[model samples]
Target: MGYKQRISLLMLIDSLIVLVSVVFSYWLLSPTLYLAPAVVGISSVTLFIGHHIFAHVFKLYKRVWQYASINELLSITTAVSLSIMTLAFVQLLSFQTVYSRTLLVTWMLHILLIGASRFSWRLYRDTKMQSDKNKKRTLIIGAGNGGTLVARQLLNSGTSELYPVAFVDDDVTKRDLTIMGIQVIGNTKDIEKVVVEKNIEHIIIAIPSLIKCELNDIFSKCAVTKVKTQIMPSVEDIMSGRVSVNAIRDVQVEDLLGRAPVKLDNKKIADYLTGKTILVTGAGGSIGSEVCRQVAKFHPKAIILLGHGENSIYSIDMELSTITDGIVIKPEIADVQDKQRIQTLIEKYEPDVVYHAAAHKHVPLMEKNPHEAVKNNVIGTKNVAEAADEAGVTAFVMVSTDKAVNPTSVMGATKRIAEMLVQHMDMISETKFVAVRFGNVLGSRGSVIPLFKKQIEAGGPITVTHPDMTRYFMTIPEASRLVIQAGAIAKGGETFVLDMGEPVKIVDLAKNLIRLSGLTEEDIPIQFTGMRPGEKLFEELLSENEVHSEQIYPMIYRGKTPPVNVNVLYDLIEKSHHLDKGELKDLVLDIAHFKTKYLTQLSLVE
Candidate 1:
């Protein structure tokens, strides 16, 4: 309705209500209907003026009545009560006497009529929306504030897909209680039962504060029901205006994994990162780009995007550029293996911190091309570390893979050597050099999740390397944030490992993805391909000397790396050029898998 029309309508309704209330009040209290015409007339005018004045004061005309709540009711009460009180005061002045009974009667009528007029609009809308047959019946898990917020928003939205039918909370006190007209039916244990009884078509996991194990358990229960389930948008996201409260999203593999992220100490991270010039190698790659994004959050003085691929470098440069208004973003297309180019860029940028994320990480690919792996993962790290050392960089954090521990694959061995190079550099250089070791970042360029998703899209036979193969998985953001966090805590020569929860079986991961796509095992059959060459049945996050992911305090555990045999390392680096693939693999394995002890033992035997 137009503003003027709405105001005129409200004014007319209130005026008529005032007339009826005062006249009816006078008739009930006085002996005759005409006993006090002048008093009745006076009371009507006073009530009308007082009500409109209070209504204006409370912004009653501006209120959206169809979404009315207690606040709107309170405004109506205040306006009606004040209008009645003003009538009594005016009666005393004009007639030299006040009719108390008449005034009380008029007060009750005014409140009832005005409050009903406003709230009835909300009542009608709620009733119409509640009867919507098109909306899916939704069951909310968690009757706490988060759940209540979701219910309220869903109830208010006319075109929402889900209708909140019931809430299931673990809190005993909330059971059998009503919130926003929806009852809390039962606890989490009875979720399956509630779904059957309520005929729920959808579910919302409203509690984000639930521990990872608890979340996994709840999701497991939800998964069994075969009903589509989603998670509520985070309160942080809602408050930040990134999404609304009703912006629920489909469950992801990350949610099923249910690993709590490490809380970073922003103060410590900011101390090293904020306002400092930072450089990220392999800036176009998954982890490297995320590192740049996380580093930007610290308000860096500038970020240098160094990578071999121009497309990737340009893409990240544009992304970082759009997000970081004040911070300088420089995209440099230079391969990390180019020692002089790396040195030139480091000198040109004069970065305070360098995150070396460039590496040949794919196992099968690296196994076939061992020389390329050495050139990129090994030499690339060397060039970057040496340049950082020569340029007097404050800290250098090399992103290492968990495969590096007790290495089996060519990629693993190469990464292990890369870690060794940084640890070796740390000993002599003034700059603190450290490496962050992690396993299988989900959604990375070559991770299994992307592969499984593609297979599902292609409609069939999801290939699993081995039914028994397992690996630790963490989100890209988690890995990047912790990588940055590792830089903040770097004390030189320490290998930082994230407390990745228990590893997931590869077949089980495939099954979860299938289910997530709303497909059954019958829809997508699992095919067990024999284990790929140089691939392990499972990957390790740390060496025997390091504490496990669970034992680490604050999710980051650092182990002191033993010094590498410089002679043996140099020998492998020098002799690697002429050796064939088999000979090179055996030689790199000797250094990476067994370290100095076996090579020294082999030398004695020779």
Candidate 2:
């Protein structure tokens, strides 16, 4: 409705209600007495004027009544009460007497009629909008502000297909309350019962500020109903205009697996990264690209995108170019394994900070091709670290893995050797060298989540390595941001382990992914394959000897794993080519585990 028309319609209805209320009170209270026309006319006019004046003062007509609540009711009551008081005062001044009984009755009637008239629009809207039976019956989990916001949007939205049927809150005080005509049916514990009783087809976790544990608890309740569940967009996103209030998103496996990300100290990051040239090897890979994205936000002097693959480097370079202007983004198609090429780029760009993310990470693939792991993970790290040292880089951050701890696989041992290589470099080189170690990245290229999704899409048995195999998981962004944060606070030779919260079983992860895909175990069954040759039953972030008691930053811990003997590390790099896969694996594992024992064991000597 037009603003002026709406205001006019409300004013006319209010005028009629006022006149009727005044007349009814006068007839009922003083039928035997002489009902003076002057008294009724004066009472009605003064009351009407007082109501309108107060309505303007309270912004009564400005409020959208269809989404009204107690606040609106309070406004109506105050406006009506003030008008009645104004009438009583006018009567005393004009006639030297006040009709207390008649006036009291009139005030009661006026409040009732005025409140009903305003709330009736809401009633009509709810009835008209909710009459559509095709909309999905949605149960909202919170009854607080976030819950009401979702409900109000659903009620007013012609575009949305969700129809909020009821609310369920854990707070007992909010029970039995009606918001926007939707009742608070029960607590979260009653989600299944309420879903069955109300025929709820969908559920929304409407509490935006819920912690990880709380959200998981609420979702566990909703999951029991086997209903498709989603969470409302966060209040920060809504306030920032990045998304609408109703732009709710589905719950993903990452939400349940990891704890809250550490808050970065921006000033600390900016001091090291802002306007300083950064060279990120494997810049096109998952963690590498994300590091570039996060680094760009710090406004680096220039970003050198170094990677082996041409397309991945090109893709990330173009993406960075579009998001930012005036900052130089240089893409170099050079393999980190090629020492000469790496040194050439390092000399050309002279990046202040270098993030060495290039690695051969797949456990099974690296196990079969241990030589590749040696070339890319161990030797590649040496190439970059040496080049950075030669170029006088300020900080060199090498990306390591949780598998590097107490290594069992060729991949893990090679990465462990790489970690030791960097720490050894930190001892002699002027550059501050550190390794940021993390476990499985949830959605990285070739990560388990994508593989499970593909298997689910293919409508087959989703294969898990083992029923008991567990690993720490973090989102790519969390891993990348912490990697950058670690570089900011680098003291030489330290291994920064990102706090991954807890380890999740592979079977549990598969089951959650399947259920979140809106499928039950019957629809898509899970199969347990034997663990891979290089895989661990469970991965550890740090070995027993490397455990620390305190955190350097939130969600980041200092792991002081002493470096391997530099001679054995050099021996692995030199003898890796001549040794077969089995011999290579044994040598790398030996070097990774027993750092000093390699000198006594001369079996790997050429």
Candidate 3:
């Protein structure tokens, strides 16, 4: 039937119910008195009119009982209560006798009949929705509020393909209890058993507040069952109402890092970035692109994206263009090693701050080609810092790595030289020059995590340099945010070290990745090769004698390095330009203070 026709039919049924309730109440209250037909007729008419009028006013007939929720239930209560009140008042005025007891009985019966009719359709719809043949039997990991929400949504979502069969919560009190008709079979340890018993094809992790260790353990158990696994967003995200419990997603490597999200000081960042024209050297790189994103939030006047790679530069430029309102984004394709190009651009733009991030960072690649590393990391940094100094920029921050401490590889040596150059420039230049040093970024272009994922995808043994190797790790945004925070507190010639929580073992990382991908170590073996050339067992964040003091920012610390003579560095830079591969390695090692053993090893390589 059409909408209007259906509503009219409902109204007719409700009017009949009103008449029957009032007559039954009158007979029960005064059975000895012969009821007058006119009195019964008038009272029934009064009740039928009152009930229908209130019901129509509340739009009660417009609701589809098959999809009814609490709102609809409330509407039924309101319509019934209001109608009873109107009938009781009308009977006292129009009739000689008042039937208070009968009216009370009628009110209770009317509510029960109305509520049952509406909810019966709801029950049918839920049962029909869950009975789909294509629905996948699902298991939920959490049995608290988060799990309840997911279960309620899946059961009521008519088109959903998942049917929650069981819940696995660690709370003992809820061991044998049921939620939304789903049983709480066991804790995370019984995940495999539950999956086997229920023939569950999918598992949803509804514990948004789970710690990394607990999540890792639960994920390992799910992998053993060989079932598809998905996780909810973080607790903060869910609590903020930005995402729903039903919005599940595939688990990522970042989720397994076991590190909390870095909290940034917006006032500090905005104080330095507001109304300033900023220049990011490696704007296309992972760190550089994130820097642009964070900087744009401060409402900068203009930003210059300078990099040699056109594709990466273009990508960042387009992305910023969509979100930026008044910020002028200028993408310049220029190599940082070209001193004249950098100097000329700085002269033209006159940027308020210069973030020099361009450098060749791969250890093995730099070991084979030391000349390129020197030219890019050392010379390129010198070119940018000097240009900023000459241009009279407000502040200059250079990105440095943990490997620069007590260097053992060509990459580490080059980055250390870059840090020293920044320190020396701060002594004489008007521009405040500083360097922010940290360890490995999680998902950069050529990071190890992505490499392991690819190896797992190929269904073969994943390669690891050493079984015991470890490195400090942080997210790309965390590193970028600290870089900006470093610039805000820059005085001159200080190396800022970010507080990376702990070093993660490479083998453990590999094993976790295998599990996250729904496979076990036995499925994809991990091969341990001996350490590669220029690779270290562990990375250091500070030199032996480098003194550090706490800074105003919570995560950043300042390190004082041994002073270097600028004129000597300039002479070294000039002389190295003429040196060949063998000569260049020697100069770089000596200048960066590499250990005798490493230098001897490199010398023996060729």
Highest TM-score against the true fold, candidate: 1
Error of 1 at 371 (Å): 1.3
The CA root-mean-square deviation of candidate 2, after full C-alpha superposition on the true structure, stands at 3.9
Best-first order by lDDT: 2, 1, 3
- In Å, residue 264's CA in model 1 sits off its true spot by 1.1
lDDT of each residue in 1-606, candidate 3, tens digit only = 998899878887787787777777768775643277766777678778888888888888888787777888888889899888887787788775566787797888787777876788898987886777799999999999888888888877778888999999999999989886799999988999999999999999988898776777788788788898989887866775778756888887777776666677888889989999999999999999999998999999999999999999999999999989999999999999999999999999999999988889999899899989999999999999999999999999999999998787889989998988898889888999999998999899779989999999999699998988999988898899889988987888888888777889999889878878888888899999899887889998877677575555676778878776656666777778688877787777777883444334322311
Local lDDT at 420 for model 2: 79
Model 2, runs deviating above 4 Å: 22-53, 84-105, 155-159, 172-186, 233-247, 258-260, 297-301, 318-330, 549-555, 562-568, 571-590, 593-597, 601-606
User: Against the correct fold, how does model 3 do in TM-score?
Assistant: 0.89
lDDT of each: 0.86, 0.88, 0.85
Model 1: per-residue Cα lDDT over 1-606, one tens digit each: 899999999889888988888888788777564475777677778888998899899888889888898889888888888877887789899888888888888889888888888889999998887777889999999999889988888888877888999999989999799997899999999899999999999999998667667877898788778899898865445665778776788888887786777777899999999999999999999999999998998999999999989999999999988888799999999988788999999999999999989888899998999999998988888889999999999999999988988888899998888887888888889999999999899999999898999999999799998889999999999999889998898878888888788999999999989888878889999999899989999888777866534534487777765676554575668778898999888878878855445656323311
Tell me, by lDDT, which candidate is best: 2
The better-scoring model by TM-score among 1 and 2 is 1
